[model samples]
Target: MLETINRFLQKWMLLIAPSAVILGVTIFSWLSSYSYLVKWVFAFISFVSCLGLNIRSIRKAVMRPFPIIVCLVLLQLIMPSLAYGIANVFFANDPYIIMGFVLAYIIPTGVVSLMWVSTYNGNRALTLTIVLINTLLSPLLVPYLLHFFIGTQVSMDTYGLMIGLFWMIVAPSILGVLVTRFLKEKINKTASFLSPFSKFALIFVILVNGAVVAPYFRSFDGTVILIAVLVFIIACIGFIMGFFTARIFKWEKGVVLSIMYNTGMRNNGAGAALAVAFFPPSAAFPIVTAILFQQFLASIFGRLANYYFHVMRRRIDRRQNGLTGI
Candidate 1:
């Protein structure tokens, strides 16, 4: 019974997520009171999110390197370049804003993608592999890319960011994976019970993070709207690029789903966390606004993917029937 409810909630996360963000921003005063708890919320989210990952699945995906390599290129090279260009064009006057824009895209693939992949029946091994590999590499890659792209113009504590990623992401993930490895049966049995709570934690994270930047929303203007639009467009490009990349490689449908979500939806939560921790409060604007639209796109795209797969299955079945009749 509990598992059924959790599955229902996960299926409708699209609606639930955006609603949470909106509610958070509306009651900013109440939410802001708990502002001090944002980091701990993020830490808890990371820990619970990792509990689902299986080391064996990650290893299976890693052994098949082609999709992994393509995802890395899209993640590291293509997405960053696109984001950097967009930031420079629109936010040339403020280096912090540009930093926010860059950080939004440069962070690792999100742990949340695992939820989407599982719901859509995508290759769990491949999704887990990409998420784990990206998470592990983030401690080094995120800072390096920031420094490489923006130079001295955008000041960030590279070492500090690395340390944060290590403790927040790397350590928690390893802990979860190890626990799952040793106690697979027990963990699986308990997962359904705990799933809803983990999701509530995710909403709590969003609400608190929204409250942190809620004051900015009150005095919204043309520039804020423009920045939001730019972020949305750039984010969509990530999804579109992922779609093309999957088609070019002629990947299996499951692999294609993994690619689209991995490419389009980054762990923007990491971007929000980084902005709040290392940069000015205003630097978090792009990352915060991004949370609103990305989830919506994921929801839309997910429905479309379902329709597409259904149509393709029908076509294949018809062809088989025709062959048998002849």
Candidate 2:
């Protein structure tokens, strides 16, 4: 019965997710009073989500380093550059928006991205490897990326950022791996039972965090709409670039899916938190606004990729049949 219900939830997860966020915002905006608690929830979500990974997958990714290198290049270098370029063009006068834009891309990919990768039958090993590696490196990388792109215009709490990354990502991941090593069966069972709840945690995060920005949403101006449009375009481009690059490299289907997601989605939650903590409120605008559309875009990209994959398969089948007859 549990398995059946799991399947159902998984099937409609994309639809259910956005709805939950909307519902959460509508019903629990007041819960924003305790938004500080969301960090622990974020940590818990990270732990359980990664609990399923084992040494074998991590080793596999290490053994074959090409995909990891390619993914990292796409994710870290290409996407950040793209975001910076776009921000410079769109908001040349506003350094805060530019900082926000670059920050969104420079942060590590989200932990919840594993859910999407799993939903689309992606390479779990590579996804976990990329997420863990990115998270592990984010402390140094994020600050460097920020300095490189924005120069000394923005002030960063380097120590605070490091602490946040370690606690939110590295610590939870280590605890999760330990649980996997020593209490494998128990952890696995618990993760399975609690897996769906991860989505709720995400929704709650979005809700509470969304409320913080709700005031900004109520009084929108031309600049706000422009930022939203620009973000949407940049995000779509990330997916496209990842998809085409994976095809060029002739990666497996699962790897392709993994690249699509890892390239497209930023750890917006962390980005928002960092922005609010270190930078001005204006710097967090892009990051906060992104939470609304990131998941929605993920769904669209997944379906689009599936459609194209099927089309290519049908073409190959037809060509094979024609050659057989000849």
TM-score, every prediction: 0.92, 0.90
Q: Which candidate wins on TM-score?
A: 1
Root-mean-square deviation of every model: 2.2, 2.5
| Per-residue lDDT over 1-326 for candidate 1, one digit per residue giving the tens place of the 0 to 100 score | 77887887787777777677677778644776765566666666677677757777778888898999899889988898888898898878888888888888888888777777777888889988998888889999999999988899966799999998887778877877877777788887766677777778777867766777777777788888888889889988988788679978889888988998899898776678778778876788888888888778887777788788899889999999999999
For 183-234, candidate 2 gives per-residue lDDT tens digits of 8778778777777676566666666666555555556888889888888888
Compared with the true structure, the alpha-carbon lDDT of candidate 2 equals: 0.79
The TM-score between candidate 1 and the true structure equals 0.92
How far is 11's C-alpha from truth in model 2 (Å)?
Answer: 5.3
Model 1 lowest lDDT segment of ten: 28-37
Question: What is the alpha-carbon lDDT of model 1 when measured against the actual structure?
Answer: 0.81
Q: Residue 268's C-alpha lDDT in candidate 1?
A: 72
